[model samples]
Structures are given as structure tokens and as C-alpha cells.
Target: MYAIVEMAGQQFKVAKDQKVYVHRLQTEEGKKVTFDNVLLLDDGKNITVGAPAIDGAAVEAKVVKHLRGDKVIVFKKKRRKGYKKKNGHRQSLTEIVIESIVAKGAKKAAPAKAEKPKAAPKAKAEAKPAVEKEAPAKKAPAKAKVKADDLKKIEGIGPKIAETLVAGGIATFADLAKAKPEKLSEIIADVRGNHVTDTWPEQAKLAAEGKWDELKKWQDELDGGKA
Candidate 1:
């Protein structure tokens, strides 16, 4: 099971035992935290999408550690002004291990109840009829196929990331087209830690604009280290 949860100002899609890093929270290390803003849940069989977020659905996580991100160098330069400034900054972050996911009001199977003693069976001799009723064969429900381009169809997904999403069952243009940036960000973060924003929404916008060739060209440039 997996759930899409919101923490700090960002959303995260997490599954059991998965570790996630996000903006630092006030909670201490090793403490348990519950994310109430559960936007979606997938139980392998069915996906429950939240309208603004599913009511009564929650994701439980344990704080693993509090740490700082790698130093980011900020360099500013002015042409002909001889003005140059260099600075470094590190962001505080929290590492969390996802626990169980629960959907509100989901029914649990009840344990077998005790039964009373059965009465003695009556002895009766009867001839069995040769006629038999045929039981109708049950048909299996059709499984939805995840498409390779569906992930790319989302508002902020790239080719490689789209491959991951498609393999993970997020196939279909409509499925990805309906996904929010925040939700897609969560999925991307889960896949490629900390680098989800580089080319997500932009790619999605291109798909939405029917600019498949342009999108592929841009992706090629990025892959070729041109950008």
C-alpha cells in the first residue's frame, strides 16, 4: 500500500518502509508523525483519489533523522561592474520512514464468531435427481493498462521518470493529465530524491500544448548534457 501525503508545504508519495526527506518539521527524531493530508491511496488493486484529499485517510511515518542538505553555492556576477559575490547555504531537512497507510472507514474482516451446538441430523433415504443446474462462469474484470506516455502526459513528468511511473502503474494520459503538480511532485520526489522540479511541470505543459516533438527534443538536449 502507498499513500500521497502532504508535509510541510510539499506533498510526498510514500509506501511502507520508504524513506523520504522533506523540509524540516518541529518534531524530534525517532518520533512518529501522521500526515493528515492524504490525497491518494493505492492498494495495488484499486486507486482511491481524493477530492481535495480523502477524508479519514492518513499516512503514518516515523521521523528517522534531522539533517542539512548539501551546500548550495550562490554566485552573483555583474558585467563590467566588477561586482562578484559568492555565498553558500544549506537547508534543514527531515528524514522520515513511512509506516502503514490506512483509509478512513475501511472495513476490516471480523473474526469468526462462536457457534452453538448443531442438532442431530435426521436420517432420510432419497434418490438423487440426475438433472443438475449449471453455474454461470465468472468473468474477470479487465485490468487497466498503464501506457508508456501516460507519465509524460502528466503536468510535470519527463521521459525517464515517465518510464518509472508507467512501470509503477500510472499509465494512461487521462490518469496523468488529471494529476496535480503537487501530487506529481510527490511521485517524482519518491522516484528521484530532491530533483523533482527540474523538468516536470514544463514537460507536462508541453504535452498539454501538443508539443510532443518539442518536448522530445528538449529531453534529448538535456540527456546530451546541452542543458
Candidate 2:
């Protein structure tokens, strides 16, 4: 029998006694772990597939060891901007051997969150005045339209970097201008390429101050978001 399972943000195919290497997990070495994210199972002649992930299905494995992968070089450069940056990184990994795949009686995985309860019905006698109700409804959509700014306007930020900044709650030009470059680098550590953030705050400051012509002038002189 063989099964396809997900673990530590990655997927793999495995069978009994088969070993695999994956991203490092929080579990210690020489310990047993069970993953309840079984996506598919095949037993010789029959097959089972999940709606998203099969319920009550699981895979058991034992952590054999922990190690780090080879170092990788990340380099970045911008044309005519005299900008160049390079760095190295290594990935942490774990080795595990599959012990078994269970199709039933496994702890059920909670995939979706429970829906919120509906608000209680309003009292009939309290029939609210229509004047008060009309204003709130009109204001709701106006507030919703005030969305985060296009943070990519800053030179050094690419799609991934802008997404990271948004996810970290730094979504506006004003907000980015107020942030420290050190904090920006720490938040964007997951981005693939090496980055220089020294000039990001200054660019954001220009944008926030509505100095569009000046900001564009400065950006044209920049390379790969570097000054």
C-alpha cells in the first residue's frame, strides 16, 4: 500500500518503512509523529481520495534524524544603479520513516472553522426608527473602500516583499515611512533574493508627503530598490 500525505508545509508519497526528508519540524529526533493530512491512499486494487483531505485518515512515522541542507547563494543586482547584494542560506530538514497508514479511527482533522452564530432576532416592540438605520448602511461601504495603498510604489519592494509587508500590517505609504529598515528586513526574511532596505523608508517618506515628482526622480536613479 502507498499513500500521499502532507507534512510541515510539503507533500510526499510513501509506503511502509519508506524514508523521506522534509522541512524541519518542531518534534525532536527519535520520536513518533502522526500526520492526519492523508490526501490519498491506494491498497493494491482499490483507491481512496479525499474531499480535500480524507477524514479520519492518518500516517504514522518516526523521526530518524535532523540535519541542514547545503548552503545556497542568493545574489541580486540592478542595472546601472551600482547596486549589488549577495547572501547565503541553508535549509533545516528532518528525516522520517513511515510506519503505517490508517484509514479509519484516526483522529479527525478539523479543516474548516465553525460558522459564527446568527445574531438574535430583533424585538418587534423595539422597531427602530428608519432615520437612524439609513445612515449606518450608507457609511458601511465607504469605509470598506478605504483599502491599503499600493505599497509596491516604493522602489525596493517587489510583489513578494509588498505582500509580506501587507501581511505584517505595514500596508500604507505612511506606515512604511514610519517603519525602521531593520524591522522591514526581519519581516521579509522569507523572500527568495537578497535585499537592501536602506532607502525604503526615505522613498516611503517622499510618497507619503505627496512628493510624487520628487519620488519618481529619486526612483529613476535607483537600482533594484537600492539607492
Candidate 3:
């Protein structure tokens, strides 16, 4: 039997005793890990597919080791601009050997349930005589609500980060411009990646001032919000 399972953000077709290398997992070496995201499974003569992932289907694997992949060279250059940059990177990876494929009845790790709070005691109602009151002669006009700006316009600010920033009350370009890089980092701490917000505030300032041309020029020279 073979199964297509998603592990560490990547999918692979695995079978019993098969070794596979995937993105780095938080699991320690020599420990066993269960991947419940089985996309497809085949048992000799029958094939089963999932809408997104099959429920109760899991692929068990044992971590072999943790290591880094081969080095990758990244080269960047601009014609007639005298701009050239070269970098190298190695991706962290983990090796694991598939142990078994469970078609059903796989037990998932459930979170601990929190105890519910007790209900408040009900208060007794008291009857009181109603009094007639005079209404105000005039009411003040409502203030206009400020529209949220598309923060994705700023380089390095993706949909997830933009949503997170909006949730943190930094919705408009003016608001982003006024925010500090350290605070922005704190707001997006849950987001994956080594995001650099050094140029975000300046980019937001330019956008807030309606300097699209300048902002675009600066963004073109930036690499994910870093100078």
C-alpha cells in the first residue's frame, strides 16, 4: 500500500519502509510522527481519493535525522545600473522512514479541554415607577468613518500580514506610517518567515503622501522590505 501524505508543508508518495526527505519539522530525531493529511491512498487494487484530505487516514513515520540540503546560489544583476548581488542558501530538512499507513481509526492528538465557567446567580427584579422625560431638541451629526487602505500595496506586506496588521488597528497607510518596525514585528510574530519591516514605515509614509511613483521606485530596489 502507498499513500500520498502532506508533511511539513510538502506532499509525497510514501510506502512502508520508504525513506523521504522533507522540510524541517519541529520533531526531534529518532522520534515518531504521524501525518494525518492523507491526500490519496492505494492498496494494490483499489484507489481512494479525498476531497482535500481523508478523515481518519494517517501515515506514520519515524524521524531518521535532521540536516541541511545542498547549497543554492542566487545571483541578481541589473544592466547598466551597476547593481549586482549574489547569495547562497541551504534549506533545513528532515529525513524520515514511513512505518505504516492507516486507512481508518487513527487516533489524533486532541487538545486538553478547558473547564467551563460557572453561571452567574440570577438577580431578583424590582418594580419601579416610570417617569416621563423630555427629549433633546437637536442631535449632532455623525462623524465620517475612515476607509481602510490596501496595505498590500506596501512591499513585503502580503495578505496575511495585512490582515494581521488590520486586526492590530493599523489599517490605513497613515496608521502604518506612524507604526514602529519593532511593533510591526510583534504584531506579525505569528506569521511564518524572517520578515524584515525596516522599510515598511518609510514605504507607508510615501504611500500616505500620495507619492506612488517614489514608493514604486523604492520598492523596486527593495528585497522583501529590506534595503
Candidate 4:
């Protein structure tokens, strides 16, 4: 019998005693781990598929060792800009051997229940004489709309980063100027690439003050907004 299971953010077709390498897991070497995300299962003559994942289905495995994969070279260059960069990376991996596949009857962890707040006691009302009803007051005038600034104008901020900043409530130059570098990084944590935000607040401050010439000069001296 063979089963398709998801482990360490990747899927694999595994069977009894099969060794597989996957992304590094938190579990230590020689420890056992259970993967509950079985996507498919086949037992010789019958095939079972899940809508997403079948309930009570699991794959048990034992961690064999932790190691790194082959080195990969990354190269970047600009044809006429006289820029070239080369780097090498090795992916951390873990080796595991599948022990068994449980098609059903696997116990799932139960979630903790929250205690509900107790209801307050009702207040008693005193008897009072009814007076003539007054007319409702007129509504106040609506406030003027505040337009969102173009955050992309800030150095090193692309369209995706701008959208992410806007969603995080930093929609204006003033807002960006007030944000800390660490907080800004947390806001755009999902954005791709290595982003340097150390100079972002200063650039935003200059933009907020309408110092276009100075901002332009500073941007010209910067390499992708790195100070």
C-alpha cells in the first residue's frame, strides 16, 4: 500500500520503509513524527482520494537525520549598468523513513474550550410619571474625505509593498514617516526579496515635507534604498 502525504510543506508519495528527504522539521533526529495530511491512499486494488484531506488519515514516520542539499548558485547582472552579483545557497533538509500509513481511526488532538462569561443580573426600574415626548435632534454634517497618498513614491517601495503598507494602515507619507523600521519590516514580511527599510522613514519624512529635490538627490545616491 502507498499513500500521498504532506510533510514539511511539501507532498510526497510514500510507503512502508521508504526514505524521503523534505524541508527541515523542528523535531530532533531519531524522533517520531505523525503527518495527518494524507491526500491520497491506495491499497493494491482500491484507490481513495480526499476532497482536500481525509479525516483520521495519517502517515507515521521516524526522523533519520538532518542534512543540507546540494549547493545552488544564484547570479544577477545588469547588461549596461555594470552590476553583477553571485551567491550560493544550500537548502536544509531532513531524512525520514515512513513507518506506517493509517487509513482511518487515527485520533486527532482536541482543541481547548474557552470558558464563557457569566451573565450580569438584571437591574430593577423605579416607577415614574411619563412626560411629553420631544422631537429627534438633526444629524451633524459629514466630515470631508481624506485622500490616500501614493506610498510608491517612497524610495525602495514597489507597487506590492505600497499595497501591503496601505493595508497595514501606513497609507500616507506622514504615516510612513512615523513608522519604525522593525515595524515596517513586520508589516511587509510576506513581500519577496530582501528589503532594507532603515532609510524609509527618513525618505518618507522628506517626501511629507515636499522636499522633492532633496529626496531625488538622496535616492540617486542610494542603491535600492539601502543607506
RMSD of each: 15.4, 8.3, 9.7, 9.5
Candidate 2 residue-wise lDDT at 185: 64
Clash pairs (backbone) in predicted model 2: none
Report lDDT (Cα) of residue 125, candidate 2. 31
Q: Which stretches of candidate 4 lie over 4 Å from their true place?
A: 105-227
Q: What is the lDDT of residue 28 in candidate 1?
A: 85
Model 1 off-target regions past 4 Å? 105-227
**TM-score per candidate, in order?**
0.46, 0.52, 0.51, 0.51
Tens-digit lDDT track of model 4 for 1-227: 99999886678999999999976676899999999988888889888887678778999999999876775565789999999855444555689999999888433446679899876544322222121122223446779866789988877788999999999999889999999876786677667655667788999999999999999999877666665
**Each prediction's Cα lDDT score?**
0.66, 0.80, 0.82, 0.80
Residue-pair clashes per candidate:
2, 0, 0, 0
Candidate 2: C-alpha RMSD after superposition: 8.3
**Model 2 misplacement above 4 A:** 105-227
Residue by residue across 1-227, what tens digits does model 1's lDDT show? 88888887788888999999987676888899998888888999989887777877888889998887886665679999999754444555789988888887443345589999875444321222222222223445779754345554432345777776566555655455556544554454455333333345566567767888997778654421113
**Residue range 1-227, candidate 3, lDDT tens digits:** 99999887668999999999986676889999999899998999888887678779999999999876775565779999999875444555689999999998333445689999876544321222121122233446789988999999998788999999999999999999998876786677667754667688999999999999999999888765667
Model 1 worst lDDT run, 10 consecutive residues: 124-133
